[model samples]
Target: MPVLVAVVLVVAGCAAAATRLRVAAPVLLVVVGALAGLVPGVPLVEVEPDWVLLGVLPPLLYSAAVAMPATSFRRELRTISGLSVTLVVVSSLLLGLFFSAALGLDLGWAVALGAIVSPTDAVATAIARRAGVPARVLTLLEGESLLNDATALVLLRSAVAGAGAAVSVGAVALDFVLAVAFAVVIGVVVGRTMLAVRARVADPTVTTLLSFTVPFLAALPAEAVDASGLVAAVVAGLVTGHRAPRVLTPRDRVSDALSWRTVELALEGAVFLVMGLQLEALVVDVRAQHGSLHLVLGVAAVGLALTVAVRAAYVVLLLRSARRRVRHSAERSAWLDEVEQRVERRVQHLPADGDTRAVRRVERFRARVRQARHDLDYVLDERLGPREGVVIVWAGMRGAISLAAAQTLPASTPDRPVLVLVAFTLAGGSLLLQGLTLPALARRLARPATADDRASRTRARMHALLDEVAAREGQDAPRVQVLRAQRTALLDALEEGALDPDAVGHALDVLDAEESGLELRGEGLRTS
Candidate 1:
């Protein structure tokens, strides 16, 4: 208990200091913990692999997914998949080969090591967010981090299971497909069921409490079936976040956000702190096992270099594809416009009040056409260029996940101590080398001030739309009613892709604040 208290205090202290010093908290906490670990007489802090993978990981991922904007997630799905799945597989295979040659390890065990380090941790998103990178770039990074863990872990399991034998590629592929399919089903069922139950509850506290169980509820069952529990948790979160606006009350939404933010901070801080504290023990184990710590460090350096090189090359390719997509979407948008015009002309020529079903079908077709065009426009507006690509490449740093996954390697695995040390060194080195330098790189590549002009225009237009809605409601209407009407209009615009989600989110917050203030005043009057 004392040790736990001390750890929390240290985490809190480091976080506070990082905030005051304008530094990334993860980077600061890791440094402090590392230095603390080396102090004479300090207790060796060892973390169980299960504690991290089962306890810390789900909540961290769930919180992130709940906060992620689903529209952006869907929009960048292709890029995210390329990075999270395709890149992970390619990097793991290449690193496996490299490690086999460099470390004189068996192929399967080397590949297992590769898989342990493959996924970019969600901590990278927190770092990138602090750097004020473009929203599209942040989305890509967040999406990649959210989904890549499943890919890496699945690969690791396969490699471990077939360490000395020929692992069938077809079997691995089939297993992956089934795991994902099952996880998705589990996630959807859990998400919708919880949302339905929460909708009937009136108390904000109760709803928030229910929200806490969501990740575990989604993850446990998925894992029971040998599926990707992390993916299940992520899916549940995305569903909740996307649907919360419609199903949850304003108070409930605010409560969940505030509480989850606290949980995220505490869990994330502890993970990094623990990461740093474990370094000395890992080194000790390497030494006790007669492993060459110096040689392992060199191997970690090579692994880090390979990871970055692969990411940079993949990101460049993604950007090229994005450019081509923009051009293709533009052409498709024009073609749709022409088709809509012709369809409208034909509809106008039809006899009035004739074939009502046909008229309804035509309207439905037109609605689909309009939606398609809006989606294409969204794609065009959020195009990724070379500058964004550079940020994405540099921001792909490893963190807690790599270290935790490394610890999960079987005890009997060959050179276990040496492999674990290499993983720790790679994670720490990546954090220090990439995390510390990312902010500066992000600033240098940041979009010019002129870029905000479009955002300003969008906000102004959104506010104007709200004002018009309020005017229609009249000054005689209840204040709450007026605010609710404005909110409805804002959400409608968001759904139509006519207003930016960021702008709409801000507008909704304003509405919530006003309503909350009104409720507070009413309660005060009643008490008085």
Candidate 2:
């Protein structure tokens, strides 16, 4: 218990130091852990793979998914899937072949090592976020990191199983499909059921408690059925986040955010610290096993180079595609406008007392056309170019997840210690190489002045919206009522794609604060 307390203290202290120094906390924590491990009396910390995979990962992913704007996630789904799924598969396979030839290892074991290192860490993307990378780039990075784990882990499991027996490509593919399908089902059920329960509960404390159980509730059942628990947690989080605004009270939402942010910090900090501390022991283990430390380091370096090269190539293609889409946006917009006009004409022809079902269908079709046009406009406004592409490529740093996944390898697997060391070195090297340089790169590739101008305009619009709501609600309406109306307006703007999600989020925060203040004042008056 004392050791645990000390670990927490160390993590908190390092986080504070990082904030003060304007450094990435994960990078700082790892460095601190490594230096502290070298102390004469510090005990060797060995983290069980289960501790990280089962305990730490689910909540971290869940929190991130909840915070991810549903609209952005949907907007970037195609790009996100390409990175998280296709890129991972390609990187893992290519790296596996390279490792096999370079190290003379078995194909299955080599592929397992490849899978371990393929997924980028979301925690590391905090560096990119702090560096002021554009929102679309951050969305891509965050979404990739959030969803890629399932792909990598499933590949890892297949590789490990193949090592002992003949596991066919068909079988592996089937496994992945079933895992995702089952996890999605489990996640949706758990997410909706828990939201229903939480909505009925009056106490914010109880609501928060139920919220805490959500990730695990989604994960545990998925894992029980040999599915991807992390994916289940992510899906549950997305559902909760998308639905919470309508179902949960503002206080409940605020409480969940505050509590989950704290949990993310502590858990993420511990993972990195433990990652650093374990490096010394891993080194010792490889040495004890008569493996050349230098050889493992070389392999890790080569592996890192391979992954980076693949990512660069993939991102270049993505950028080219984005440029093409932007180039042709005017044509697409015109076409969409024509389609919308036709729909409007059709709506005009429909009788007011026409068949209700036919009218509803047409209305839905018209809404879809409008939404498509809005989405296209959003794409044009935030087009990615070479600079954004560079940021995306460079920010693909590996961290705790690689090390944790590596540690999960079977004990009897060939060169297990060596493989673990390679993963550790790769993660450490990536963090130092990429995380350290990302901020400078971001500054160089900074978004244009127009981006800031757009943001300012959005903020002005938000204020205008609030004033309009106030005027409509009337001066005699309660302050809380006015705040609620403002929040509803902000949400409406967000849905219509008329406001930036970040701007809407800030406006919502202001409304929540104002409402809370009014409630407090009312309580004071009643008491007096």
Candidate 3:
């Protein structure tokens, strides 16, 4: 019953959000989940860890990866690599150190805590991407998010191992490497197989379901082999996303994208609502334990502060390194800025034929990468990338997992619980408080909205002109005299404020018809 209610709430939340925020559906789902917690007797259901890491994470990551052309991802590997691999590891270490010291917890234990929560989920990044963030910026955020989950989860397992003597440091390190490598292999294998299956099957719905199951299948194998289930699921999605294009027909391609998006949205909402509802258990446990209120606040503050500081520092370093490399590469290129521009222009003008399509595609992709690289060039580049990256990093906050981790903590003794009430409180609060606000916080740090006045006015004028021009001309205006008469009629319509912005849309539709008519005839043929 609660699950059904949650689904109803999610649907209503999406509708309301469309009218109010104009943000992505996932963001609204999260808000719905958090807010719904306030209703009395609304049971806070504990979402299974397997379901979260295996079921929810995979499709979301896959959908995000697929929405992006595989070409863009390969081209922007540098940006993605920095965020996904380097920053994740560094942030995990820094956060671990901070929490351990500030909260009077064991260093190893704190590091374990940090590792588990280190990776940000793709849910936040995907929603942010749809909200009009830049391509490279979105890539960086999403890539980091997609890959880091595995790394963090591995660290989490390792952290759990320190509690026992069964696993040695060297063995743990080897296992981590194996887990990562295995996740990649499993993901690719599953993805390739599924893509082949999708090609054989024409039914989009079946293909979609098959795509959905790949993650679950990959996750089981990875977990059976003591690997990261999150990593396995993500890799499976990524591989399948990147491959589905070649295997499926154009219709399948369309269906794949649509189905991926729909599945991702549904799963994301389910996860966020589950995250919020689960908060009750943590709250109850902490309160019952009579945990130190000050301690909880302190720990939460420390985790929040550390996450912020390390992320800021990481962004600064990444931008600095990218800038330095850019300058060095520029010097090595012997100032080929003009040459690069010429190449780009040539690529743009190249005839769109089947044979040249491949070459043109490559050139165009490289051009986009070059442009992104140049923009991240010397112009106070430090400030923009660093700020954006840091904001995203903070937005990576996860409270539900931390709360789960707290619950997983064993009793230290009869009088003392190893899962410190304060820690659990901090975890739950961090998930709810920080997770809920991160998107808004990230948005505020972005540059102010620039005036689109000139573009807007030109567009408005064109739309007004086309609409009036079309209505007057219709299908009988092929004669120059008829065209002139149509123009006059269009003028009269415009004089009546028929050129209003909303009406411009209708105008554009007419213009499209006019253009289509022209295409069907020789030069100078006009459409009514």
Candidate 4:
């Protein structure tokens, strides 16, 4: 009954947020969960730690990874690597040291706490997306959140071992490397195998079922081999996502997308709500235990503070350095542009009008300049920028994973209740404080799209759609191409300034409806 109610609340919260309120869905779900907890006969929702790490993490990670833009992810690989591995390790060590001093925890236990809370949650990334953050920035955050788990878990195992025995830095590094390598190999092999299987299966229903199991297929085997299941899931998702465009039919793609979106929406809401509803019970449990409330709260406050501080410093330094490099390249491009323009003009106006060599050289130089400028802009846009840096730094809200990690600690561990309570506090506090404000921050930081930029993008999209339509080779191909041609002509006129922006937008909207009808008819005819 509670589960049913929770699902209803999740659905309701989303509908209300979409149609009426400006509030975040996660926030609303959390509030609903808390109020429901106060109701008579409502049972407490408890999520097991192993269930989270084993069952929940895989699909969520896979879905996010698959949805992520591969091009943007590759471009920001360096940033992602720095945040996932280097930042996780650095934050773990620093916070571990802090916990040891402030909470009087053993070094190993303190480090365990550090590892638990180091990675930013997927919920935070989703919130950022809802807040209208730039796509590239969201990619970087998503990439970081996906990979950081493997690193944190490796560190966590080492920390747990250190509780009773000595563990070396080299050992930890070796474990991390091996875990990632094994997970990669497993993921690729499984992904390819699945692709081969998918190619043989024509039924979308069966294929959808196969696709749903990919995350587990990737995760379980890797985990069985003592590798990082999370990494395996991510890699599998990436490969599957990359293949989806080529392998899956339009209907399959549509169905798959809807299925994953539904799953993601439910899991995200339930996870957040469950955490909120459990907060009061956890707090009470902590108070009933033989620990100081001040101590538990203090550790949480200090740990969250340190986590935010480290993240800020890291973002600032990385963004500044990236910006500097981009600016330098942009300056060089400007200089090259000037020289190229001058040379082109000189060649064009020369007395020897048929100086082919000079003309060719000028054109080549112009191409070179254009390429350099494009690269510079792409780097700043897709990799790092000051405005995006500000938002990313603040989007480090923790989620269910932190609580699960804390709960996974051994029963023999000291101050277990207090530790769990502190972890819960940090995760909840971060969510409420960061998740609630992220949308407003993104709005403030987002650069408004210019009219020219918007128009150019729309025109380019129309051209791409036309090309896709033309590529079709069936009984309906000619008709589709002709219809697409009309759309293309409309866009071309809009681009040429024959139509106003408003008129162009209206035309495109009509074309969208027309295209949907064509696609539906095509599907129906094929099925018939």
Candidate 5:
């Protein structure tokens, strides 16, 4: 425990430095861990893969899902589904074939390797976000990464169970369909039930405890029934997050945010650090066993290359299809607008009484046509183009999930050392190679944020904060009224240009903190 504490302290320090330098935190932590492992008297850390899957994964995934904007997620559902499920399955198959042929591995082991490395890591996605990737592309990548793990894991289980034997494809497909359906139902049921429970509890501490517990509560049962726990956790998060604005008090949200961020940083750092330590140990193990380092490295390199290539190809094809559809929609929309205008002009020329009804009818038709065009544009806008697609493709760098999945592979698997080495090396190489260049690529691909975009984001945040303040009911209402009045005065000053925008923002934050503190005390009083 003492050594563990020391390791965490060191990793935390490194993470802080990485953030300050604008480098990827996970990559830096991994490098630090590798060095730590190399130092004499520094014991190597070994975390059970099951610990990660059950304990670390649920909360990390839940936090991310809750943090996601529920409306945007729903809006981009189709695109997210394709990238998360369809692309993951496709990439896994292609990589499995490549690895099996290239490395002379059994088909099942090859498929397992493919599944192990397929999903884009959340750590890599975070690095890409720092690189200035567009919000839309980032959302798609995040959504895809969060859900793809379950898909890859499902495929992996089948491959591992088959042990290189041919499995029935139709049966696998049926299982996938059923697993998703069951997972969604279970997730929704758990999430909604938890929301009600939290609402009644009223005690902020108990509410926070429920927030932490809900992920595992939702996931483990689903996994027990052979459904996708990843999907369950994500669904639960989405449902809870959508309700959180109303369900959780300002104090609860603030406390939960701080606690979760701490948990995320610690777990993320520990995962990568342990991986680096494992990599160090793995290198020594392979050398002692007289295994060919060159062969393992060669296969890992090939596997990484194939993973990126498959993703890039899929992105290119998807972009082309989306572009063609957008062009078709625009053309049809132009024709519709022209016809609508012609009808209105003809209606205007008719006799007064007869044309009045016709004019109103034409107006209604035009409104519907306008709405149709808007709907089409909304759908098109969510689809990835070449630039966004490139960002998503590069953001496919691996992290904790890949390493954890590698460790879960059964001991009897052929070339076990080789597989483990490749998994570790592939993950590290992705971070060092892809993580290093992702920011540069994202910057090149990203469009600059427009003024309207900035304003929209600002407006949305203000409304959300104000809505929370409004929703804080009970014994604290009197104190809340004063805070609200002060907030109004700040807004008035900002509107009059008497106060700087930044100053008003800072003041509002301070006021929000004060309000939250009061609410927290009130909740305590109520509990007593």
Candidate 6:
């Protein structure tokens, strides 16, 4: 425990530095663990399934889910679900079938492994948000990462059991359905109860505890009943988050925001750090070694190649299909070539005096404004209610679990157990490697080519703020010129993607109507 604590402290320090360097925290955690392992007496951090599948996953999922705008789910339910659910099942089967054929693992065992690996990655997808990726891609990847794990896990358990004995196809199918349904139903019921309890509590700390306990309560009961613990945890979290805004006061939200972020940071660090330590255990048992390390590496290489090939093919198909559909819907989306051409048009607009820095900030806010607009339209066009709850639920990807599961190998298997370990290592690596990197790659590939009305948006908000202040304090709102000056400064900061919507909203609030030289007797003055 002391050694682990020491390592964690060192890792926490490194993670802080890595954040400044713009490196992913998981990447840093893994590095720290690797270094810690080199010390002769540095012990490993041992984790039971209870710690991993139960303890860690729920809080992480909750923190991520709470921030997911429920409205987005209502709007993009079909597209999001298709990517999260259908894609997960398809990818899992492909990975499983490939492993079965290439590694000589039976179809069942291979499928089990595939199911385990299929989920995108909750941690990676969540982390990608900070990397300047578009919200739509983050929505799909993060949501899929959260939900796909349970789907994969349930399928894997079914596949493994069926692979061994007289289990029927009916049996596996029943297990899969029951696992999901039971967990969802249980989670919903428990989640509603928790929300009710929280609505009655005014204390922030107590309410936060209520939030923390909801997932575990939902998960444990579901697992105890042979249902999906993970699914239950996720659903419970989504429900709590879905209800939080309405039921809890702003103080509650503030408390949650702080607590959740701390939990998120610590838990995420622990996850990758622990992974590095425990993955060290999936090694050779000298007495009954399965196969040559070289052979395992070979299978892993094939598996990695297959994953990349499948993913690339899937993306091409997805992009093509989406483009064809987009052409019919909006009439103006750029073709791939056009999008590239747009970069040229945009580049020419760059200030020749090397003010790329200023241009870049303007460009970023324009991008955010575009996305904010897209998300807003989605909220409008889609009929999102509780049933439209697909966003938070579907956003459940499982990268960390898959990595942790890789560490759970029995250290020995079929005289060629090395093959299994190698396959897992390869698959896990691809998941970490691709999952961590793909959003960035995807953002680069398909970032929209057009810009939007940041200047106008800034002006409009400033006007609104000014009008409100004039009403409140009986003073004229700030002048249009002053607001414009403030906006110029704000846009400069926002261009580098440093602006928060709330901060922007607050900027709007700073413009008092009374302060802007407009006044009326018990009536607000409108901005010019």
Which number leads on lDDT? 2
RMSD of each: 2.8, 2.5, 10.3, 6.9, 7.6, 13.1
- Model 4, position 528, has a per-residue lDDT of 20
Clashes of each: 0, 0, 4, 0, 0, 33
User: Candidate 1, which ten residues in sequence have the lowest lDDT sum?
Assistant: 519-528
Residues 1-528 of candidate 6 have per-residue lDDT tens digits of 776577568667967887686666676676667567666776656677557877888768766666654544544566666665676667778988887876678777777677666666665554555644444555656566567677767776676676666677688778878888999999899888988988788677898877778778898899999998887877787777666654665455666777888778788787777666655555543224654456566666776666556555555555555555544445433333365466567767776886878788766756655554454333332222221122222223234677655444443434334543553466456545654564455445433432124334545754565455445544454444454445454444333333333345356334333233333242332433
lDDT of each: 0.86, 0.88, 0.59, 0.76, 0.78, 0.61
Q: Give the total clashing residue pairs for model 1.
A: 0
Give Cα distance to truth, residue 93, candidate 1, Å.
0.6
Candidate 2: residue 252 Cα off by (Å): 0.9
Model 5, which residues run further than 4 Å from truth? Answer: 328-383, 449-528
lDDT of 5 by residue, 1-528 (tens): 897798779778988899887789888988888877888887867888889988888888988888776645764687788888888888888888887997788888888888898887887668876776665677788788779898888888888876656778787787888888998999899999998888777667778877888889988999999998888998999898767655556566666777888888988888888887877789988877756699788888988888888888888877887788778877887787787688778766777767567778776776566555554654454456677887878888888898899889998988777788888889889988988888888887766664246546556656565566556544456766756566775554343333324335555557768878876577322322
Q: In model 3, how large is the Cα lDDT of residue 467?
A: 59
TM for candidate 6 is: 0.72
Choose 5 or 6, whichever is better by TM-score: 5
Query: What is the C-alpha local distance difference test score of candidate 6?
Result: 0.61
Per-residue lDDT value at 454 in model 5: 51
Model 3 lDDT per residue over 36-143, tens place: 777797766665556666556666666665554444455456766667666666776787787677656666676666775556655556456444444456666667
Worst 10 residues of 6 by lDDT: 386-395
Positional deviation of residue 344's Cα in model 3 after best superposition, in angstroms = 16
TM-score, structure 2 vs. true = 0.96
Per-candidate TM equals 0.94, 0.96, 0.69, 0.81, 0.81, 0.72
Cα misplacement distance, residue 298 of candidate 1 (Å): 0.4
